[model samples]
Target: MAVVGGGIGGLAAALALSRAGHDVRVFEQARAVSEVGAGIQLAPNATRVLRDLGVLAEIERVAVRPEVFEFRRWDDGRLLSSTPLGAAIEQTYGAPYLHVHRADLVRVLAGAFPAERVAVGRRCVGAVRRPDGAEVRFADGSGTAADVVVGADGIHSAVRASLFGARAARFTGYVAYRGLVPAQRVAGLGLGRRSTVDLGPGAHLVHYFVAAGRLLNVVCVLEESSWTREAWTDPGDPAELRAAFTGWHPTVRGVVEALDHPLKWALFDREPLPEWGAGAVTLVGDACHPMLPYAAQGAGQAVEDAAALAACLTGASAADVPAALARYAELRLPRTTRVQGMSRDNGTRFHLPDGPDQLARDEVMAAAFGLSPDIDWLYGHPVPASSSGGREGARRG
Candidate 1:
């Protein structure tokens, strides 16, 4: 099998398929396989898959276990809602919820994936289905054929574009600034081992412990009527960041001020595709369903997609590849689509102006505080995996 893009979803898919006793290779666009981001929240839905992949323990070693997730009013710093998330969540969900630096998580996954099978600097241009299987084409004037080709490539996936025509992503008119602040710098402020978000009109700020509580990851999102930039690597002006949060709580302002450099990127998500793939070629992760960051399930959903794809493909023969890909899509599409919608809805609620609707939203949240059942579909769901190495195609090497 050929997997395009060695990102979290791609690596997880390769690892899951390998453990299910299949041979897979991961092709990464960059010269080196690394992740560049602030932090990622591994809700139980994701940690369960990482545990099954056998990397959750290593990940937890460098990750922080937040005791609670809370929301507060932006101006007055009044707590609006709080949910317990440490031991209680682990017991109920069958996995731990964690916050880890993106680089650390990628390092652990790369360590587990077979290095020789991973080829960096190979940018996949597109893919085409053959009678027997599928062929993946690269920008380097090279191509490879496999029984199945998976496009784990991200939002602008070339494979997706190749199978389905090009479609532009809809920008949400929101830009996010992300940075990590040394925990010690904010020690005096008493920011505990918990995830917190300050909600305000037209904007919101989230901060949580990561890197075993050594750093606090801060993500501030603001709505802009006229600003339209999309690059993810653009350096943000700290002055502008501070100015944006001028009237926010002191703690919120302090977090922004401590960041020496923050990455600013316009938020964009595509409408879910009617179908995830065709023939023996299929997509996983953001390639198929991209969601806003409001729900913090972007990474979690991608992890789930990997596990589902592996489950559907295990025990299938070369002739069964197309059916397996189709099954993978059938299993994942609804869940990811629902999540995409939920994330979009949350984005709208987070930026609601101070009005009756905002007050009603706050009341609903406060009333639902500490109710894990409300999110059971999200945190309590499990991704299917093969208990034994699958049928005739099982390759133990």
Candidate 2:
């Protein structure tokens, strides 16, 4: 198997497949397979999958387990709702909720996978479905053929374009600014080990601890009328960010003040594809279903995709490769489509202007605080099991 793109999802796929006794290689475009300085939230749904992958111990070493997820009003700093997450979530879901720096997670995943199997600096230009199997063409005048090819490349996926033409991602009229600061700098604000979101009209702010409580990850998203550059490393103006959240709560203001260098990006997501792949090739993660960050399940769903793909292909013959890929898609599509919609809807709900509708929403949130059934379907669910029996695949040999 050949996996394209070495981001979190791609590496996770490669690791899972290799662990299942398949010879897998990863093609990464970057010279180094490291992520940027952002934080990722791993709900139980994600941690369960990670635990099964046998890397949860290493991940826990660098991850901070948040005690709770608290939502508050942006202006007055009133707690709207609180969801217990530390031990309570683990007891219910059989996994911990964690916050880890993106780069640290990538390092851990890459370390678990063999170094020689990952080919960096190899950019995938396109892919084709050959009679025997599939082939991935690279920009370096090279190619790799495999019994199955997985496209875990992100939103601008070249393999996806090669299979299903390029489509423009719909802009969500929102821009996000992210920054990381030492936790000590914000200690005066009394922020603890919790995932907090401050909701206001037309914008929201989220902050939590990462890197084992040494660093704080701050993200602010606001409605933008015009800007549409979808790059993640674009420079953002702290002054502009501060001005946008001028009347926000003091805690939010303090986080903004501690920002040293913030990166900004416009939020965009594609409509779910009718079908993820064709023949011996399939797509995973953002390549198949990109969603807004409002729900914080982007990475989690990708990890879930990795697990399901590996499960479906665990013991399939070369002739069964296409069927295995389809089974993976069938197991993942509905859930990812639902999550994509949930993330999109949360964008609207979080940015509602203070009025009757907002008041009603707040009332509901306040009443249903703590382990509400509303999210049980999301965080409480496990990866769908593959129905394939214990037949060894000829391709694995």
Candidate 3:
């Protein structure tokens, strides 16, 4: 099997398939495989897969196990909902919820993946359909063939485009600015032990400690109708960011003011596809389902996709590859689409202005206080592995 664009999804997919006893190769666009300084959440739904792959132990060295997840009102910093996440949640879900620096997590995953099978500096331009097998063409005028192809490439996936033609992502009219602050610099923000978010009209801010609680990751998302920038390379002005969230809680302001430099990118979303894989070629991660950060499940869902894909491909015969890919899509599409839809709904509630709706939201939060079942389904779910590694094509190295 060959996987394209060795980002988080691709790496995880390769690792899953490799462990499932499949010979896997990964092609990454960059010359080196590394993740940026941002932080990512690993809910139980995702941690289960990483644990099975034997990658979470390394990540645990640098990950922060937050005590709780708190949602606060934007203006006054009043707690709307505070859900316990440490022991009780862990005991209930069979895995811990963690916050880890992206680089550390990537390093941990790369350590587990077979290094020789990973080729860097290979940008996949598109896909190829040949008589015998599936293939991918790289920008370097070379190509490789494999019995199966997985497009773990991200939102602008070349494989997806090659399969379905070019399609533009619709802007969500929102922009998110993310930055990291040294834990020492902001020692008094009073958010020391939890993943917290302040929600309000037209904007929201999330912050949590990462790197063993040595650094704080802050991300602020706000509505922006006039601005239309689309890529991660788009630079941000600190003044504009501060201005957008003006009059927010003082601590929230402090998190923003502490940004020596930050990355700001416009948010975009794709409607859930009726299908994500066809024949021997399949898609995973953001390539098939891209969701807003509202649910904090972008990485989690991608991990799930990789696991499910590997599971479906397990124990299939050479001629059964297409049916396996189709089964993979059938198993994943409904869940990912439901998540995509739920996340889309989250934008509305997270950005509720000071109105009756906000009041009702606050009331709902108050009722839950420290134990909101609102996310029980999300936190309680785990991706199960397929135990079918003994079929016709299972003898491959």
Candidate 4:
């Protein structure tokens, strides 16, 4: 198997496949496999898959287990809803809810695989499906063939373009300003202990502890006239960020004030694909189903895809590769489509202004404080038993 893209999703896919007794290699375009940015939430759905890959302990070492997710009003910092996580979520889902540096999680996943298995600066330019196997050509004019090819190269995937032709990603009319603040600089703000979101009209700010609670990861999203380029490393002006959320809660303001260098990116998502893969090649993560960040499951779903793909290919004959991939897609497509819909809907729900509908939303949130009713379906539900390791293909076929 050959996996493209060395980001979180790609690495996770590689880990799952290698652990399932497949000889897997990762082709990363960058000189080295890495992830930038501050924090990413590892909900139980993702953590459960991580545990199977044997990196839960290492992730836990650098991750902070937040006890709750505090949703509050942007203007006054009034609590709208408090959802208990940590032990409660773990007990229910059999995996812990954690916040870790995005880079840290990527490192742990990459480290799980042998160093020789990953190829750097090997950009995949095109692919050709041969009868014996599928082959991918790289920018260096070199090629590699595999029994299966996975396009986990993310939203702007080259393999996807070669396989499915060109498709534009919907430009979500929002820009996200993200940064990490040292815990010491933002001390006594009552922040860094729990994950918090300040929801307001047309804008919201989310903050949580990462790097073992020593750094606070902040992601502030807002609707603005200028749409940032769809790049994560786009630089952001703190002044503009401060002006946008000028009248927000003191806590939110404090976080903004502590920001040394903030970066921004235009948010983008794709409608679920009609087909994830065909023939001996398949897609995973953002390459297949890119969802908004509202649900915080984009990465989680990718991890899930990795597990499912590994499960289907385990102990399969060469003739069974295509069927195995199709089974992985069959089991994954419906769920990812549903999640994309939910995340899109939640994006609208999160930024509603103070009005009758907003009031009703507040009331409902207040009533359900300390418990996210949706967690049962989102976190506690079983994810196709990807851990069974390759038996699913035969059983389902």
> What lDDT score belongs to each candidate, Candidate 1 first?
0.88, 0.89, 0.85, 0.85
What are the per-residue Cα lDDT tens digits for candidate 3 across 73-146?
Answer: 98889888888888877898899999999888888888899799999999999887665568889998999988
Clashing pairs in 4: 311-390
Model 2, 104-134: lDDT tens digits are: 9999999999999999999999889998889
Name the regions of candidate 1 deviating beyond 4 angstroms: 226-230, 372-374, 395-397
Estimate, for each residue in 1-397, the C-alpha lDDT of model 1 and write its tens digit.
8999988889888888888888899999999989886898999999999999999999999999999999999998989999999999999989999999989888899999989999999999999999978899999889998878889899999999999998888877888999898998999888899899899999999999898899999999998764554464579899998998998899888888888799887888898898999898999889999889988898899889888888887778777778888888888898889989988998899989999999998998889888545378899887796744545666321
The candidate scoring highest on lDDT is: 2
Candidate 4 lDDT trough over 10 residues, lowest sum = 388-397
Question: What are the clashing pairs of model 1?
Answer: none
Q: Pairing residues by index, what is the TM-score of model 3?
A: 0.96
C-alpha RMSD values across all candidates:
1.5, 1.8, 1.7, 2.8
lDDT against true structure, model 3: 0.85
TM-score for candidate 1, residues paired by index:
0.97
Candidate 4 per-residue lDDT, tens place, 70-144, comes to 889988889989888878878878999999998999999888899998999999986778896698889988899
For candidate 2, the TM-score is 0.97
| Clash numbers, per candidate | 0, 0, 0, 1
